[model samples]
Target: ADLSQKSHRYVRSEPGGPPGKDVYSLLRCRVLLGRPYLIEGNLLAPNALHDFLLCDDPTDALETVAEDWVTTGHDAFYVRGLQRSAKSERGVYNSEYIVFHAWQALPLYRVDYTLE
Candidate 1:
């Protein structure tokens, strides 16, 4: 299964506007999904959030795409049916994709989320 397809499933947030102002100084939030994830690392050096990177390289980051829709290079569904062994294995398969990114995008709407 394409775990990436399940995109924001791991964000794990309850309904809310955000944490208190103190949270801003104590924790950093994840982009796309509003979760208070990493703590503010060493203040001695600037740009400490780099230490909380989920991936080593930004190139590893995939282009933004709909989570429910099939990935750019992958078919939505083909593993549904196992082929028959008696005859030439051939069942029916059709790929389908439903867009779910809208649900993820709305939270970050026109709101300003600056760390003030």
Candidate 2:
């Protein structure tokens, strides 16, 4: 499937906002799908809630375009994408290195905790 053809919307947390306040942004991203096993490294990070990894190098990172998409119960789909380190003509990375990044959905809370 050519995942990059579609624009995916994602909710991202704004890094710097009003003190003691949380802000978010809706991002429309273009991504390419790939294999799930292509993700390298460990699932847990020091203090991160989601699991992700950095490809060994730029070429390896670019392969993440084939990573599979993960869907959450809240109806959010997440996966990794190849981002260029610097801007290039026509969105082509050329010789610039690529970065691998992924997304995750926040925890969901059910109003009715007890089962009927």
Candidate 3:
């Protein structure tokens, strides 16, 4: 992503997730070389920014230790994406107190763009 083009702003788009639901997310975009493009952000650990996060990847399920070995908390260090994980069956949502063992796929938000 182009650091020089990165711009943060608030926007209201059509609701597609649920009815009467207020959703919030961080959006980072850039305009480089007079061309408008979207820039992707990553979920990083405060202690390990270079390391890849499993939560950032799409999968039926994700498993991470409740306790962080390197850091003090198992927090989601997001730049502009998912804010929290449920730590239950829903994992990321508070649908059920149960933990979902069944393979449940999640949508990937990672996108990329380049200037030609």
Candidate 4:
């Protein structure tokens, strides 16, 4: 549960600044040990980030809603790296979700990275 290595970015919507003004924050974190652990307490709350459940492989049957509100309207917040499931029939598998609020924040349409 140590988030020391994690990096975060915060953005606030301007203009009228309505109640609960759409605020967005990006957190980059890694789990030394892979598993589905709860990262944020509340997904729809302000300054909340998503949980990440890392897995060795991917699953197919799991239907993922890329645009779910829990993803904070960020396409980068959805599940990834799921190509096989060890416990496919048992329905027990590993995954991760970038949890966030989506009401006021603009959608995260894309993510780009160059491997080192």
Candidate 5:
């Protein structure tokens, strides 16, 4: 995800520094990409059942974990999409969160375009 096209602003506050030199980084787009492989086997982890499965294919992994969650009632993560701000004038921004078991899946790409 290329964030070069997004409109953004940078703020810097320094006691005795050159103008706009305090902060070097600002709002930018970050991306994460990953590849998962599919495996056919019965998952049997001693603990952390609700965690995202580490696999070649996340779709198949998710299905395997979901089926286990249904049959065993194990802990799991849920996806949540949240607005970046309740009130904004520029445009709409959004963010997503994995409430639980975020560390289970192998992270590939994380696209983050956050501004503060």
Candidate 6:
């Protein structure tokens, strides 16, 4: 499936505030007509969360995406690295590459492949 086509709503820590502080530090993402997944990672360094959020590098965000995919009954889904470009900036820039990097690291989490 073309997972990129899916639309997502960011569930910030506060109703109208940015993520991180006082928040669950969770990324709630879902696929259209598909299940929802929670991506858990450190908001601080030593982990790629910072790079995944700020840098235009996809290599930093792969593990989180893959964790969500597996936990949300989409284990079969393949998370390619973020696509980089000169104009790319922030997490959105090289999201694909960051994702690939995360996948390689393999974060801790559980997967529920069976449909509910």
Highest TM-score among the candidates is held by which one? 2
Worst 10 residues of 1 by lDDT: 35-44
Which residue window of length 10 is worst by lDDT in model 2? 107-116
Better of 1 and 5 by lDDT: 5
Q: Tens digits of per-residue lDDT for model 5 on 68-110?
A: 2232332333322224532233212332222233444454543
Model 4, residue 9: displacement in angstroms?
29
Give candidate 5 misplaced runs (Cα > 4 Å). 1-76, 80-95, 99-116
Candidate 6 wrongly placed segments (more than 4 Å) = 1-31, 38-60, 63-72, 75-88, 92-116
lDDT of 5: 0.30
Candidate 5 residue 84 Cα shift, in angstroms, is: 11
Report the alpha-carbon TM-score of model 6 versus the true structure: 0.16
Residue-wise C-alpha lDDT for candidate 4, range 1-116, written one tens digit per residue: 12311221223333443465543344344323222322211223222231324221122223333322432222333233332542333221233354333432444443322212
Query: Which residue runs of candidate 3 sit more than 4 Å off their true CA positions?
Result: 1-9, 29-116
Candidate 1 structure quality by residue, lDDT tens digits, 1-116? 12322333323333343665221111122223322111111122333223432312211222221233322432111222122421122221221122223342323222222235
User: Which regions of candidate 1 fall more than 4 Å away from where they truly are?
Assistant: 1-35, 38-42, 51-116
RMSD of each: 18.6, 16.4, 17.7, 16.3, 12.8, 16.4
Clashing pairs in 2: 33-66, 34-66, 34-67, 35-66
Better model by TM-score: candidate 1 vs candidate 3: 1
lDDT, model 6, position 107: 33
Q: Give the TM-score of candidate 2.
A: 0.20
* Model 2 C-alpha lDDT per residue in residues 1-116, reported as the tens digit of each score: 12322211223345566666555533333433232333322222222312324432222233223344334211222223224532232222221212244442222331211112
In candidate 3, which residue pairs clash?
60-104, 86-91, 89-98, 89-99, 89-100
